[model samples]
Target: MVLALGGLAVLALWGLDAVRIQPNRIVSGTGHGLIEALGTGPALLVMLPLALVMALAWRPTRGREALMLMLVTAMLAAMPWALSLFIGQFIDDPGGAARAAVSGASWLVGFALILMLIDLRQRLQPGALVTLVLIAVSLGSLGVAFGRGALDSLALVQEYEVRRAAFAEAIVNHLILVGVAVGASLVLALGLALWMRRVAGVRQGVLGVLSFIQTIPSLALFGLLLAPLAWLASRFPLLSDLGIQGIGWAPALLALVGYSLLPMTRNTFIALDGVDPDVIEAARGMGLAPLQVFFQVRLPLALPLLIEGIRITTVQAIGLAAVAALIGAGGLGTFIFQGLGQAAMNLVMLGALPIVLMAMLVDALLKALADAARRGDADDRTG
Candidate 1:
């Protein structure tokens, strides 16, 4: 049955192309969407089976069975893209309309594949090979199509040979901004929370200040940094050179880090405060110093809530980082702002889409970390 379907799909593709099929230009009028579709389509396919298989572990279904069904569903969804390409290749006098239709059809196919894989995995069994094939096909296509400029929304690849470098650079910049902002926030927040807990009035006073900072809009915060940072820059030649980058990564990062402090600090303080006095007193009785008692006794018990705060702060910061582009912080936001300036919806979509994916990924990772912390704490308490 699978063989029959595959044969039919191939025949259908050939027939469609014979009729003058065309590709869509959703992201770029100059074949950029086609490149992206070619590059990313396979990745999605491979991921389909993996996601389905993992989901099965959490449900009543067997993993292998769930995977097979998902693969079948994904293959069917991919059919439209194949058929559309065939039609575009063979069609007589194919126009932009053909490309648009193909693009729309491809989106539908992708969406359907995902929905079926997820839905079937939850309700019934699928095969492991199915998922594996989906992943292979998607990833293979991506590799084959990526370097030719089909993986991008911009089609200057033929004219400019520097796109690979540009893409790599963009990826690096985004990683650095997100990494520095989130990492610094975590370290500072934790250290401040620990020290504030030791000080009698410092916790309340500091928390209030952080809360106030949180209320200030991100744009205003970035603007506000210019004066002090600039003044410092003037006082120190090295600092002045750094401030010349101005509204870019530095100011944006500073703003994001500052914004993240409130949630993390608040969560840490609350978690520490909620720790049982009995545990602290016992630790003291055991001859542990105040620092040791707080670290060994209270912190372990309070870690789960503290982690939850970190998760929230990280997600919030990702969204706020988009605004940093206003200050010359180059990120996915560059695409968005550029699109807005040029009145290009496709550019906006390209920029906005990646940011959404990045945010979701960060949120998921942090949530998983928090869950692990909670589970570990539970195990330790029980043991």
Candidate 2:
């Protein structure tokens, strides 16, 4: 799959600078969007290999293989478009516009590849479904390119290049924020939870504080952090000099971390509290120290719940991160806020589409991980 995708990207690079071929119409060419320029080439390349791999991996279950292939193809096709959308957010130029179009085309290819690989039932034939979608997209692209004056009134759409840059910026920043914030939150939550379970007063106080933080509106929480953060920023000249542009990303991240704490803490407490007391006493009677008992006995029993808390927190963080745009912390939120401010529905949709998709994807992935953990636990017990 990786090889195929790399080949596709290379193929695209080969023609990256070539003038696009367009069918003549009133408009003379497709109005440049991220999908039109760069997506198709890369998507096809990426999806082909992934679909093949999935088919091989699940060959015994044709239905599953088919489904997986179809999904992989769709994802590959969507990549170019997604890349363009993100890139559009930061730059405005014909070159950038072309790149954005290429991205959309790539995503389309991914979609097609997924469809092809998956063996689908008549009722769930994603291949047919995507084919129809591709047709519509192709027609739409053509209409915009060649329909002449039909779309003249829509000419004021932001330059694809600028939109693409913005899109790229939002994606990179959001991914980084989520990765770091979630990882840190997991660690902190785990540690805090352990302490609370062992020390009753500590658990109550920490939960109370986190719950309070959760109730505070995210935007408000960011505002509340501004003064102290700024003061600290000023006191540490090096931090200020680190070229950290604004309080936006940091504060937004802090807010998310704070919000995530509650789930982790609560889940940890519940998991630990629910543990059979006899188990702990047994471990102790075996000459285990307090640390050993918690780590060797309690932690193993509590792993499922602790993981569940992480999953919940991670999903919650994804949703809340959108609000970070209010503070100039760019993400999908930028598009949403920009559209709202300008009353542009398309822009709003453009921004919101990814956030919704990303949240769903992340949630599904995490849920799968948690379920696997639980299954492993069950297997151990049975064994």
Candidate 3:
């Protein structure tokens, strides 16, 4: 209740002028607040009812789940009008065309609202939360598609529109880089881990080398790969034909692969090594061959941890691939660097938001998979 009241107070006191308006490149312009979002009279009428509902919902007798649902609904309802008002402020610009863009306050409020929703979801049944999320996403998409929202006018949206083709291409390139690097790393790490397990004497040395590789900064690793890759391309016409080069995807993939090795190798080693000796013995006594024991028993037991390692490496690779743009490897980082060079904050956001969303979604999915694996393991034990 206190937190809800505090949030309300902040919203009322600071208002929700989350967007800044600039008229014809004017040196200064005014900001419109959510308090006056639908004009004074309408805003007052809307806010009073919403506030009353919230207050009523906060009472001890009212269900917390209902309160959370109501609050989220109210916030979503207000979003379109609030955004429209912000965009409307620039519509009648007398001087010339005007541009409206998100401000720092808007970003803060947006993130805070998202966090609040997530917190509320945590309190609800998982099935309920999933339903709510899907509903919200559907409604939000419909709103955007119907042009019922003002997001289209935002500078970030404009940047996306302008470079839509490039954005699509960048998405493809980013996936390719991450896919190839992770695939290669997984294969190599698995082989190395198996070999080291057989030859215990060299395990420490191999891990130490991978650990050293992990310690190197990503940019430095890319730089290190450049010379050898360049030499390989120069000396071998076949390598050049295969798209091997000092810069671009070659070094980017190599660097990403190198960074992935430590986590992948470590996880595989731990998972395989940690398998129960009793389980192994039972499999052998059942007349299972060495390879069969490994494939059917050890591998199945270790699968969850292996998947977890891939999840970690995949998330890491997605983010790092953005940095690969520095060496002419086209990805979302292209927009980020270009935005920085041009001093366009919205452009930077256009590049960044997708990467953030992708990472979050991937992390969530992998976590669910890991949890399922654990549950399955528990069930096996019980049986």
Candidate achieving the largest lDDT: 3
Q: Could you tell which candidate, 1 or 3, scores higher by TM-score?
A: 3
Q: Give the Cα error of residue 32 in candidate 3, in Å.
A: 3.5
RMSD per model, one decimal = 8.6, 12.4, 3.4
Output the TM-score of candidate 3.
0.86
Candidate 2 local lDDT, 88-147, one digit each (tens): 443345222222122333334444444443324333455556756654554464354434
lDDT of 2 at 127: 56
Better of 1 and 3 by lDDT: 3
Model 3 C-alpha RMSD vs. true structure (Å) is 3.4
Number of clashes in every candidate structure? Answer: 32, 59, 0
lDDT of 3 by residue, 1-383 (tens): 43474365447425656567755333235676655545767656645644554555466342755575556555655655566555765665422356667765455555555555565555554584676664576456536733743566666666777788999998889888888998999999999999999998989999999999999988888888889999999999899899989977889988899899999999988888889999999999999999999998899888889889989988999999999998888899888998888777778887898888778778878888987887887788799
Model 3 weakest lDDT span, ten residues long: 22-31
- TM per candidate comes to 0.66, 0.58, 0.86
